[model samples]
Target chain A: SQTIHQWPATLVQPVGSPLSLECTVEGTSNPNLYWYRQAAGRGLQLLFYSVGIGQISSEVPQNLSASRPQDRQFILSSKKLLLSDSGFYLCAWSEASAVYEQYFGPGTRLTVT
Target chain B: AQSVSQHNHHVILSEAASLELGCNYSYGGTVNLFWYVQYPGQHLQLLLKYFSGDPLVKGIKGFEAEFIKSKFSFNLRKPSVQWSDTAEYFCALSTLVNFNKFYFGSGTKLNVKP
Candidate 1:
């Protein structure tokens, strides 16, 4: 079975501070990784998605960026955080071999002050 | 652009009451539909999905959704809902080719009173 892990389950960051949220998938290789942000009482907004290493497609223009360093490791980063960046950040993965079903991680709650 | 619409933002129902959540997508080409449930303080879980074949798709926890191609709708139904079934349900749409990129609706929050 494949499992997705996200860290710093909760985070508090100051404005203009750097942000880094990690997501790693176990038992899967070359998976499609995605980053999404869910504001309170709003639908999820896809921030970025990566198909392979060093290949990232951004869905929306925002303060965040994504990178896939390894086949199973994806990272969401920001050089300077904005107040609007505060939200529940989610990490999800789908199989690369025509696996369209996405499995979500626990998510990271980041509050920018 | 591909998009999804969930009509009801919130719904309240007593236990044993039936449920019908409306979902509509705006994509004329080949597409896939899915419903995901997110319980309070939990991650999103796949309730059901419609790829092809069956127009009526049954999901876990006695939930079912029917896909109406003509209407471009996938409505979720539950004959009898329980308090434990109270959760936020999200309707999603994706292109058949670019499956990884999912477009989600605003979501419907269901509150089933015990």
Candidate 2:
């Protein structure tokens, strides 16, 4: 079975500080990786998605960026964080063949103070 | 703009009560619909999905959703609710034209009282 891992489970970062969240999938290769931010009432907002290594498609313009260094490793980074960047960040993966159904990781709770 | 709408933002119901959460989409073309559940302090899990074939789809935990093409709606239903069913439900839509991007509704929070 495939499993997705994300860390740190919770994060507290200061404003203007750098941010980095990692997501790695085990038992799957060349999977479609996605980054989403979910608010309290608002649903998930897709921030970025990567089809392959070094290929990232951004859904919305924001203070965050994504990179797929390896086939199963995806990273979300920001040079400077903002207060609005605080939210529950989710990392999801779908099989490249059937990309409709997605599996989510435990998620990272980042609070920018 | 193309979007997914979930009418109910919050709902409270007792155990054994029925559930019907509405989900609608405004996009035209070949689209795929999905319902996901997020239990308290847990990651989102796929409840059910509708790609084709049966208009009525059964998902995990005795939950089901029906897709009405004419109305562009995929409403989730449950015959009886349980306190463990207290969670946030989200409706999502994706199309072949968009390639891996999914539009999500505002989500409906269901609080099942014991």
Candidate 3:
């Protein structure tokens, strides 16, 4: 069975602080990774996606950026956080054969104050 | 505007009541459809998916959805609802043109009353 793990289930960060969220998948290889942000009353927004290591695509350009450092490890980082950056962040993985079907992680709740 | 649209933002239903949630997409060409559920305090999980073959697909938890190609609509249905069904439902679509990208609708919050 495949499992996706995200760190810092919940975090509270002050404005102008740096942000880092990690996501790693197990039991799968060469999986496509995605980063999404979900806000109240708003649907999930795709922030970035990666097909392979060091390859990243930005869906919605903002202050956030994503990097695939390893085959199974993905990192979302920001030099300085904004109040609008606070939301529920989700990490998802899909097999290359079936990119349409995705498996999501438990998600990280970051509150920027 | 969102490419995918979920008409129901919030719904309150009693146990045993029938469920029908409307989902519409604005993309053309071959597309894959999916329905996901997020129970309170839990990760989002796929309820059902439609790639091809049957237009009507059955998902877990006694839920089903019918895809109407002409209408560009894939509506979710449930014969009877339960208290445990109270959760958030999201409708998503991915086109073959960009299989790696998915567009999600504004989720519908279902509150099932006991």
Candidate 4:
């Protein structure tokens, strides 16, 4: 069975602060990872996706960035956060062979004050 | 451009009631379809998916969906829904050439009362 872990489950950050969210997957290797953000009452917006280590594609250029430091480890970071960055961030993984069905993590709820 | 549309933004039903959520996609080429469910405070889970072969796909929790190629629609159905079925449902689509980028619908919030 494959499992994805993300943390911290919830965070409260002040405006203009830095941000870091981590996601790790177990029981799978060389999986494609993705980062998505959902604003309140809105659908998900794809931020970034990584095919392999050090390879990332940005869907929307914004204040956030994603990195695949390891085969199973993905990180979302921002040097300085904005108030618009407050939302629920989800990390997902899909097998390289069948990449259509994506498995999502519990998600990180970030509140910018 | 590929996009997915979920017809209902929100639906309320009683337990044991039938369920049918509409999903339509706009894509010309061969594409894969999927229905995902996100229970309150839980991650999105695959309820059903359509890749090839059979147009009718059955998924977890006694849920099913039919793919109509001509209509370009994949509507999810359940004979009887429970209170536990209250959650947000999302329809997604991916083309063969752009499989990495999955387009999602706005989602439908289904509330099943006891």
lDDT values of the candidates?
0.93, 0.94, 0.94, 0.93
- The candidate with the higher TM-score, 2 or 4, is 2
TM-score for each predicted model, relative to the true structure: 0.98, 0.98, 0.98, 0.97
- What tens-digit string does per-residue lDDT give for candidate 2 at B22-65? 99999889889999999998889999999999999999999999
RMSD of each: 0.9, 0.9, 1.0, 1.1
Write one digit per residue (lDDT tens) for candidate 1, span B10-94.
9999999999999999998988889999999888999999899989999999999999999999999999999999999999988
Write one digit per residue (lDDT tens) for candidate 2, span A1-113.
Answer: 99999999999999999999999999988999999999988999999999899999988889999999899999999999999999999999998887769999999999999
Write the residue-wise lDDT of candidate 3 on A1-113 in tens digits.
99999998999999999999999999999999999999988889899999999999999879998999899999999999999999999999999887758999999999999
C-alpha lDDT of residue A54 in model 3: 100
TM-score of the second chain in each model?
Answer: 0.98, 0.98, 0.97, 0.99
Native contact recovery (fnat) for each candidate is 0.68, 0.78, 0.73, 0.57
Model 2 gets an lDDT of: 0.94
Scored by DockQ, the top model is 3
What TM value does the first chain of each candidate achieve?
0.97, 0.98, 0.98, 0.97
Query: Which residues of candidate 3, in runs, are more than 4 Å off?
Result: none
lDDT for each residue of candidate 1 in A1-25, tens digit (9 for 90 to 100): 8999999899999999999999999
TM-score of 2: 0.98
Give each prediction's DockQ, rounded to 2 decimals: 0.76, 0.81, 0.86, 0.72
